[model samples]
Target: MELNPWAVAGLVLVALVTYYLGHHSSRSATSTHDFLVARRTVRSRRNAAAISGEYLSAASFLGVAGIVLKDGADATWYPIGFTAGYLALMLFVAAPLRRSGAYTLPDFVEMRLGSLGLRRFATAFAVFIGILYMVPQLQGAGLTLGEIVPGAPAWAGAVVVTVLVGANVMFGGMRAITLVQAFQYWLKLFAIAVPTFVLCMVFFAGGGPAGMRSLGAPAPPVFPKDTTVSVKTNVTVKVNTETYFYAYGEIDDGPARGAAHWSPAVPHKVASGTTLKFAAGTPVPVVSDIPATNDTWLHPASGKITDLLQTYSLIFALFLGTMGLPHVLVRFYTNPDGRSARRTTVHVLLLLGLFYLFPTMLGALARMYVPQLLVTGDTDAAVLMLPSALLPGLPGQLLGAIVAAGAFAAFLSSSSGLLMSVAGVVFTDLLPGRIRDFRVATVLVALCPLALTFLVRTEDLSLSIGITFALAASTFSPLLLLGIWWRKLSWPGAMAGMIAGGGSVLAALIYDTVCGYTGTVPPWWTVQPALISVPAAFLVTYVVSRLTRSGRPELVNDIMLRLHAPDPLGLVQDRVVARFGQVDDKARTGRGRHRKA
Candidate 1:
């Protein structure tokens, strides 16, 4: 395990700075409003940065590169769809939701439809979605740190992030989080950009290879040096050429001396903890995916029914899912008015779009430079590992450290937002306890996902995060879009749609998660449920609202006016302030002077 002490130190240092900044900013938060929405005083640009910071999770920082590296150009749309989700938010959700002046999604639901039942249902989904989103952050952390230090337990990184994020949230609340998150966003951008710049420079300085851009199928990836590759899990490898295997730490495991098998009907298992040594000229065996040659590394799709369905399903989930995310919506509430909300979203789109460009570059370069990862299924670590592979020595390690810091920043910033959203829902809507309840909620929210990390494998993590998006899109996207635009949506319709849309997707996700563990593969439809589930949620919601006579005309009229009216009109109910003073009422006080004193 070649763990760089500097890289580990860099990760811890960012966590400390984040905690201190959050704590310092939180000192002035004396009320629940301050804690939850920063008193609705966030400016456009800062809030946009914070939103982007949280939105670019480990998936954006690390997973995108790995997916592109493994799957080629067809996987490029993940980042595009991710950035475009903001467009959906700006058009349908941002201004009106901000104008409504609610602190959380459930608050908006209750305010819009006048139903406590629906509020609880929405709150439940918020908690579920927050945790569902958070588990991957933990998984990525473990995978990242594990990649840095090969034998490190996956839980180590998760534990470190949770501790830092929990402290940040427990101390600062939203006011603190806004500053901390915005800072992390720039830090992450620097971390990714600087390394990308340096690596590209190095690639060109080494004299850009003519064969690096080969389009037709070429030879399999060759080891740049005599290397020993470690297998982290039990996987089957397709050996197209002869290779050497060292079994049980000895050079005598094959039939001649090491076991070598031809293409057999039954695939052989390379058990966990096995190590394979290859000479410099050896061809790396392909695993689990179609053979990719140098000539066609940039192919559009894998020509699989599942890949096409998964791509469209992913695009739908990410595009529609952004507006419905609980944490993302809370950032809009922190904006002072509707115009600010729209402006913030526009900035977010620009920032995210700019940051996404380099990951594709990293992925493509990684394919030529570090194809061994494709064999190990640790392509997610390609972003972190690529720098060291290209630069070598201290220069490479330093660049690698920068990437690690950005990766940790991704976990910290995103985890803090998720914790805040979950705790806010727990305190205000679900538990309804005092400020102390936030402390309790923070621990519970962090613990659930940390425990879940043990159950989920690091392989195909983008798919896992996509499944959660499917849940958010299916269940809440319909409710949010309809409640804002459609006047006649009743509380009953909202509840029914949430149940049908969210329920079906949730069931499919559970089946996939569980079945995946038992070596069972669920159908493509079950894995990517957005196309069917999202439409079903919308359909059920519209039909139920039409049949149910639950909405009152006056309440609907009031909510609609507030949502659509300009901020100068002051129609939004956000101005209600709580104040207390000596009443000095003689009848009630009996002694006015004593009451005042």
Candidate 2:
């Protein structure tokens, strides 16, 4: 249980930088306008960096690589969908969303549809989606600190991240965190990119292209050296061939728990708190659901219809979900105008594309170097472990520290944005739109998700985030797309569609999680509900909207004009100012007709 001093130093440095930036930038946040939208003065490039930082949550930083390491080629779709979702946003949603002149997604819903009820409904879902997305970031933090500082409980990391993020948001709000997030983005990029370059150089120098070819070999990956794996959670693994290992825990569902030699001819179950030691050259035992051989893993198609369905469903969710994410959309509101927002999206696309390439490479390398993680089913630690595993000694420890700091940065930046979005919704809709209420909302929103981190068992970080995306895709995707593009969308229709879409995804998530806990295999749709839910949302919204055409807002034409018209035309009004006070006004006395609506 020895702690690495270098890693601790790296984490402390990032925390100091984050706090300094937050405190320095917070001096100007005297009004709700600055706290909520940074007074809409951010330019394209810096805003893009902040958006990229916030968008690249634990799922992107850790989950993508872990999934790729465990699932093979199919995992590539996760990043593709993630990046392409922004493409969808850039093309159809980004400029208009910014032009809508709303501080939050619920604000947009109410501004467009003119229904207080619908705004509250959207607020509820916004909080839900934010919390759902945040759980992964918190869990990833737990996984990371646990790996670096041995014997640290998972909750310790979650608490540390929540405290840092909560303080940043409560004190500085969006204005301060913008600077912090932008800085962290470059730091995260360096953290992942440097290790990838060094490891690739070593791999090529060792075996060149021949080493690359070895990854595709038909045999299962083997332990590069004798390794001891600690299983923190119960998992069932499939042994491809006869293997002997020393184990100290409950095995094969037995009440007797003690040290024993495990030689399994069939699948084996290992209980939590188990420790197993494997000899060098022992074939790795992977979780039962993962591919055991490299050949099968490298291939794109699993030849199963369910696999095909799941892949397409996942793609659909990710492609449409970006626009629906509350944290991502709120960043655009920080842009000065629609044009800046569009440019920011373009820059984000480029930044995200470049960052994603490294994680995929890291995952491929992990298969060769960190096969022991497969047995414990804790591949989420692959990115943090890879540097130390490959380099060894002081160099590896330093690199590991760098990666750990970057991972924490990932959690902090993403959690800050999510908490900001959720707090904004709570402050505006649930509480009075006051400056102090904003601070309270930040505390309230952070606590709910922090508590949730303890109850929900951590799974694949990317997959858990994907479910949140599916919820976003099903609910808000329909609302935003139809509200912006369709002229006849009614408030009742929007509410109904959100319920249909959000309800289905939530049901599937609960059922699937229950199945996982009970050791039962759930159906494919339970895992990826976008294919069934997204269309239902759009269809229900359309049909109900058509049926309730009379309920359409009379101001729909004005809203549409503002959304589509160029910024220079001056059709878009400053709704933030209309609801809260002006950026310069400290009286907090500005409430217009729209606030009442």
Candidate 3:
């Protein structure tokens, strides 16, 4: 399945254009707003696109499809969970967080707590989470590059993406990257959708791509309007004189991407054939060995406790983590007003919902048409390979090229944002006082993550990303949410929470990684530290506030006024618009000479 040269050319073009745009935008940037928040001038449509572009990584595009391909209905929850989490974000964090008018989480921390020490701790944690998330994006790019260019080594792709990302980050900062991400989002949508439409037609035509027929396409799992599928079933197995009800379908070893697992042999009787079916009110035969089938994350050995805890833990991490992500939170500061922030979030949900629908469909299609992906053992490649299989020769290459371009866009856009976030923290939060030292810090931040990429290797891109989320959820989420709503929060409380919550999650993460607790450890202990740590932070904040009571509330009127106000003042908004950067529309608006933010 070597990719066509033309496809490679298309990918190269996207990289060059993206780099060019980023570099050109940053040349004139001078102020803190230019470096961090893009001057709070971005329009709703572009801002929403940038948010979606940064949020949807290679993991969502390829990793989710691969999971669905291998794990039947159980994998469907990943997309549903991802999209539903955003609704939580819109309701709880979006407008209010923006109303605070902080650039990074650290900026918000300093404003809320008025403690430089606490701000530094929060910033350091933000850097850690950003780097962790950036690694997988680099790896994904390398993999896609290898597939697209045949003889191209994985490291070559990683290097290419890293260099491009660094260039983008160094050039325009947030303002420049914002424009690149906005364009890339639409390109990604087309890249995935067109190939999917073509393949669906191919599959239904009774002649799928070559080798697709032998794999036996199955009917996709349908979502029941109501709770028709049982929450769980007791599989009674008779072994000699003993009756045991054990779970079936547990991937005991690792991911189902061609990995084998061990299970006890059991004899079962069914009224039907090998193809199992269950009608309403009918008793379905239970395969008591395999766990986590049908979008139900169950541990057969335990009664629903394990699955229930896993679900809640995952939900907790995603809900809180959305607020903590430095890149996402940073975008809120780019909007002109609280209303613009709200509008941008609504647009994000719409764009992401539309984009997410396509990926879920692709995953379902892979399950039916490309079941042998189980043999290849790289489910993340499902999105890339399926397009090639469906369209042969030029069309296949073109599709492959498009997918590669989008994958690279996902990798580079995300890497660029993370790098920018890390740079901002290092420069603005960590560096003592000198502007020269801050510039050096920016270079150091970018280079450190790029160097670390060589040491780690893994195929579980989605899981790696989830780990980063867990860390962010534990640390910054609690701090930000509380700081925004509460007036009593002081430097001591914020600092105590930072060390207690952030340090604990970091320690747990390091221990988990080193101890080889791989295969998604028990959900409660593994999902996100927020479930335990968030409450602990609240307790610490409460205690610390009482002990070191600050007579005056910091920024109380500003925060409250911003939250409840209809829109920004006309003059203030005009100043923001005058300073805001846009691609190709500067001259038309007669705002060209101003510095880019």
Over the stretch 228-265, how does candidate 1's per-residue lDDT look in tens digits? 77777766656555555444432223322344433424
Give the distance in Å from residue 221's predicted Cα in candidate 1 to where it truly belongs.
2.9
Order of quality (TM-score): 2, 1, 3
lDDT of 3 by residue, 122-162 (tens): 87788888887888888888778777777677678778887
**Candidate 3 RMSD to the correct structure:** 9.2
Colliding pairs, model 2 = none
Candidate 3, residue 85: Cα displacement in angstroms equals 3.4
Error of 2 at 497 (Å): 1.0
Q: What C-alpha lDDT values do all the predictions have? A: 0.80, 0.88, 0.64
- Mind sharing the TM-score for model 2? 0.95
Quick one: best TM-score, which candidate?
2
TM-score of 3: 0.78
Please provide TM-scores, in order, for all candidate models, with all chains considered together.
0.91, 0.95, 0.78
Per-residue accuracy of model 2 over 323-431 as CA lDDT, tens digit each? 8999999999988789889999999999999999999999999999888889988899899888877777887888888889999999999999999999999998888
Candidate 2 residue 113 Cα shift, in angstroms, is 0.8
**Weakest lDDT window of 10 consecutive positions for candidate 1:** 588-597
Task: Answer with 2 or 3, whichever has the higher TM-score.
Answer: 2
Candidate 2 wrongly placed segments (more than 4 Å):
207-213, 255-265, 576-578, 583-597
Best by lDDT: 2
Candidate 2 has an lDDT of 0.88
